[model samples]
Target: MADTFLKEQVRARSIGDWIALPVLIAVIFAAPFFPAVLTSVPNWAILPVSDWVGEGLNWLARDAGVGGVTFADVTRALAAAAEAPIDWLKIVLAEGWVTGAGFNKVQAAPPLSWLGVTLAVALVALRLSGRGLMLLTLVSGLYLALFGLWVLAMTTLASVLLCVVTALVLGLAIGIRAYRSPRTEAFVRAVMNVMQTVPIFSYLLPTLLLFGYGPSAALFATVVYALPPMVHATVLALRSVPQETLELARMTGCSRAQTLWKVELPVAVPRLAIGLNQVVMMTLNMVIIASMIGAGGLGYDVLRALRRLDFGAGFEAGMGIVALAVVLDRLTQAAAHNQSTQAVGLWRRRDTVLALALLIIFTLFSFVIPSLGLWPKDLTLTTAPFWNGAVSFINREFYDPLDAIRTAMLLKVMNPFRDLLLATPWTLIGLLVCFAGYALGGKRAALTVMALLLFIALTGYWEPAMVSVYLTTLAVAIALAIGLPFGIWVSSRPRFHQPVQLVLDTLQTLPTLVYLLPAVMLFRNGDFSALIAVVSYAVAPAVRYGMAGMKHVPSERVEAAAMSGCTPWQTFRFVRLPSAMPTLLLGVNQTVMMALSMLVIAALVGTRELGQEVYTSLTRGEVGPGIVAGLCVACIALIADTLLKSAAARAARHEGDIHA
Candidate 1:
């Protein structure tokens, strides 16, 4: 049966497939004979693109300009304007307003009382959602206050709020424009693809050069990082608006603008809210990374803790970020889904009036009772000693087993895979990718994949790129192995679904930085640690997508399989799995992207990959190398994304054929 199936498969191939097979095979066999030519791109062929790009950017920053003003001057002016609001918000949230510099300064007013802010947030949550969210808001706010993270948390909150607002406005405008013009949409889609695939670190390099080092650069980076998702969400939401709604608007003699504002936008609100949630989460994520550029907040504290090897301090700050993320996520989600009817006048609304009254009352009381303004330092708590003790005990008691597992994994699995990838000839790999692309997609995909790979090779980053690929590939495999089964089990057991989903959601919500802390604490610095961090960070998508796929499988198909005398395992293997293959492949794509993203952060734990290259370039102020390394990482992500999407498409088609 196997031989017959193999023969039939060979017989089904087109002439092009047959021709391509031998060419791929020949390239693989010929690689060893011409190692110098095939194994790597030689010096003569390597392009100095990074240097050229660096020079061009420097000129744009320093020399190139129109009229009397240089580009740097314009950017500085804009930065100054943007900085004004941020500085004001900082004062309002944490740093009380002052009239003068140094010892000569006089306090104009204390910032909003922590008591007031907490009450206001709770009121808003109650008004938009219900008692559950209100309680959650109160608890999260209290956690920050009690842990002595109020000031830093507030500072981070200010930055996040500003960035989210900015990103939303810009994303809406751009998305609306793209919706109106197909050409514009196509162009914007291409740009968004690059923006989404490019590692977050790449964004800081250009922002740093243009805006200089400060909150301005961090603000700009945060906005850019968070902008793409909002734009995507806006476009998708607008496109998905019901056709019946549009027709009704036309029948009612509505103008285009009126149709959009009065009909489409209201309908799109729920979906757009999801985008808002994404923007909020992404802004928080970037804010932490932006701390490296002087955007001080909880992220700065976390960074400082990491540097000092103070695990306790880092955990506290990281939890502060999680608390903030949860609050914002819930508030925004509730606000979007809010369906309560409002009175004619805003002042007539009981909840709104009460919330405002609470804000005013608390702020007024803060002037006489100063403790209400900010959580008193002496009243705060610390878990640093407890955490330190726990870490010491674990290390002292469980060191051998943990070290043994790490060593075994590295020696037996990771190193061998890394060596194989590094030893593989670039030419053979390139051809293999081309053939795979052609087989999965077509000529366009083939050309695109080959070109992207070629660009990486020509830039002289192939070796490190291979290292990155090895780490990501292994991490993704492990994540899928673990997540897929768990997701399947949860999907099969109805009672487990909600709890498992909540766990996955929380994992995804935590910033990538937090994953590094535990991994580094346990495994120290190496591929093993990086692998653990990447897997923990990337596993959520796998579980989420897999569970979704399994849960969505048609009940009719499962019933039919069972009725045909199949056992439960046979029904799943033959019926449910095939039906879910396309979605599972999509899950794989997401897992790969998430893994690649975490790998960059894992560089901090001393992995020698493209992430390290980018980090090195950032620290050394080498724009050219940083940009090149970032692009290489982006290429790897795009390649994986494209191939997996193609495979998913093929699976869907095959499934459809089987159904027919």
Candidate 2:
């Protein structure tokens, strides 16, 4: 009887809250139209968060000292320390180091002949995976050389290697420490969360400030950007080790270091290998963006092409990046999954010896035939003219239709949505967000979003924040509109699946900078170009999740639907879509995050959003403004992530209840 009474009270309260929700929303929406006193955040209430951050940075730059060294001095010294190895690597890989009397280019001397490098890569691939990857590596090397991009690709690869090594070392140390201490784990996790969410562009300026610009600064930014994933992956892998296994190590009188080396690390290899894969991918992703600060390579080639509107050249450079990414991705994945014995008798090590012997022979041959050491310039091919011609043809033939579509999208959809978002009072928007938070995750979430909104407002970037939200919202909406149905259609067809997935993979993995100019060429610079690029970039996840969810649906449920005599559309709409909704929402959350991440890049195409603010601050070296704007972006991402995650959780719970 007491339980029944409590249930009744709870039900009554739920009804009351439901009744009040509409009223609350109505007041918020109507208040904006009524009076500023009721709806708008007061002008006086806007705090100078950026100014405060600037002042802090200035103080550190001025008065902060340790061991008789000022902050700036310390930063410069650290920069100098980091630069030394990078310089050595740069020279060895592409720039040729100095010898007895003068300098010689690596390309001119060729450390390992083109044949040796190609053959060595093939052998590594063969050892790592099998014949297929060996062929792939051979093709990749030939492609780089044939296209006259070998040196440039190698230059990028050199920087990426340095960055990856540094990130891995630091990430592992931190991750291991966190794994051993709860307090350390908590602190690391908090920092990792911030680092992961903060956009890459935000890291650039502060790194430049401290490192004083160059490839080294770019490398520093890349390390900071890519380190979080490695740390998280390491922590996860370590924590996943069974307690029984660990306890056994303890029972055997293993010291902590001994246990970590002999037991934990061996067990953690597969997981760490996955982390290494992530580190490689992220390192590659940063290659192009890092170029903006003078970390030259294939990225510089692409950037130059974009500035010149040379679609052919840009496309070629972009393809080189894709090729490099594919090779690394495959190699790392193979390494992660490999479980071969490394210890063997010398009699069985003939293949390794033979490979090394071939390399040495090729090196000797290169001295006699220098052209073999480096790809002959006369033998290289250029596909840029072909690509340029194609671009020109498309522009001539489809210009009008493309222009109309671009204009219609801007005039009919994007502009109005943006204006509505920008014009809405912060109070109304905050209330709406709070309501959403409350509905999705109760009072705690509501409070969290309220705090996020208040913080954004205090930063004096409210309107820019709204602009980013507006762009992300529209981009995600369009992404879902296109990607969802495509995913559904493709999921039902086996033959189409792999091909579609391959394209999507390329779209997702291709660097963000690759699309900057292609977008401009198609849509011209404006919100349209930015939105187009963002949608293109963000849509892949939605489709990926949709297809995955559908593919994983229970066969029994599907068969039952067929037995019910439902039409294909009806079955999909009623059964499949419902099952996939949770996963789709998770994809949408990813899509939103991707769009926000692209915001700063989009600013290059002329979108005057928070991205532009961050970009402007970055260019002007205004650390305080740049950092605060970045935090605002992070705040926006956190809110969206939280609400969507809560919704996904609720959906999952509902499904579980139904299953039970």
Candidate 3:
């Protein structure tokens, strides 16, 4: 009876299942006899795609042109335009105005006072949210002032502000266009997927090549990196505007532009604010990464400290970034939620009036009193000594156990998993991926997976790609293992929810570079360290999504399960788990993407993978190879994302069927 039922089920499967099952079985059976194909793609079969791309880019940069103007000229013009505002902002915030050049240079005026900036930030916070957020902003600003990081922090802030503004404007325009046309939206969505997935290093190369390596290159890259989320948010927010409001605008004889500006935009402001928050965070993150190409600010400080093996200095710089990120995040979030009626007059707005007045007063005073402009050097403190001491204590006392754990994990787990992936036939693995994609999403998905995998194989990056896969796979597994259960537990325990959520929020807000500090401090530099860093960065999504999934499970379903004589465990397992599966899968998708992103950064800590390829190419100025490797990483992310999303969709459909 069981055999008969299984056979009937197999026969009833979809066309995708039919194709995938046979391919999977054939690959399984054929692997042993085709031993030569088991390890890697043959050298003769590897394509010179990277070389071709490099040459194409070179031509574009040096020779290609229209109307006798070179591509380089255009890029330089754009870079020049971008640099003007960034330079002006930097001068206003940190550099101060100057006259002349070289030895003839003279300081004409000081930048805004650190005290004034701090008060301005606090007052803005107070206006946006309340006293609580104002206090937080004040503390963050004070940290920058007192830690001697005010200059670097302000420099970073300048770049961030410029990048955010650019991204927001561009994204908003593109998003509105996309919303107006399905074709445009589809194209933009596809481009966004690629843009968001490509490693940040890939962006640096073209910018570097075209812009000739400076803050302009960094600015351009930062804008590109941060623009996608804003575009996505704008489309969503605009789409979500109440249809009745739009109808009302139409009935009131409003033109299309008027309707959008007066009705849709006003209604969408809150959600648009959320997107603004994302753009700011992403801009900050990319700005730090862009530092290598001369974005120079706190990120450069952190990078230099890391290169010098000065953990304390790196920690301090990283913390400065953290403070900036927290302040910005809080301010944006507060702005998003602030819906209080506006005062009629500028003077009636006490918070803004006071903040502006204080800023003006401080600026005037700074002209006579230099100390009022920049915080006093003597008053600033160094926590480097304390951090260095703590690192020393840990190394002295905990080194053995930490080393033991690292060795055990590496020798017993990571190495073995990596070796297995490398040893496995690329053909077989590719087939399996295609099969999964087909089973989950039909023919289009399978083809997409196959093409992406084939590109990686042909580009001669398969081995390192596998290494990336191994590490990411392990990290994501561990992250899910840790996060899912914790998320579940917290979801059930309301008392634990807020604190845990707060921790996750803080973890997410810290720049990716900061995660590396402690990992490098403890594990030094290797795959183990990379794994630790990636895991730390990736775990938050898992916990957040898991908690959301569990919390959203229907109470009625649980009651029904209980009425059917199910125990609490049975109800959770049979009812809640199935219901939450789609969300959990989405969480897995997010976790994988985060791990891939961090893996690129982890290249700094010495992981030999596609990320390293991109990083190496960047250092060597090999645009083609760097881009190819970045594409390979993107391919990996897309594959995981597609498969998981398809699976989630399938699960939802199944659930819908069951409910019906």
Candidate topping TM-score? 1
Alpha carbon lDDT at 147, candidate 3? 84
The TM-score of candidate 1 is 0.95
In angstroms, the error of model 2 at 508 is 2.2
Q: Model 1 over residues 1-660: C-alpha lDDT tens digits?
A: 997995676566566788888888887777778758777789988999899888988898899778989999988887888899899899989887889888999878888778888988887877677798889889988989888898899899889989999999999999989888999999998888778878888888888898898887899999999999899998999999989989999999999999989888888988899999999988888877899998999989888887777888888898889889988998877766663232223222777778777777887788889788877889999998898788878888999999999999999999999999999888888888889998898788899999999999999999999999999999999999998888888887888887887687678778788788778887898999999999999999999988988977889999898889999999989889999999999999999999998899888889999999998889888888898899999999989988999999989988887987
Query: Can you write out model 2's per-residue Cα lDDT over 207-289, one digit (the tens) per residue?
Result: 87677778888889999999998999899989888999999999999999999998897788778878887788788888887
Q: Which candidate leads the pack in lDDT? A: 3
The TM-score-based order of candidates, best leading, equals 1, 3, 2
Q: Report the CA-based lDDT of candidate 3 relative to the real structure.
A: 0.89
Per-model TM against the reference: 0.95, 0.92, 0.94
Error of 2 at 507 (Å): 1.8
Stretches of candidate 1 off by over 4 Å are 1-13, 339-348
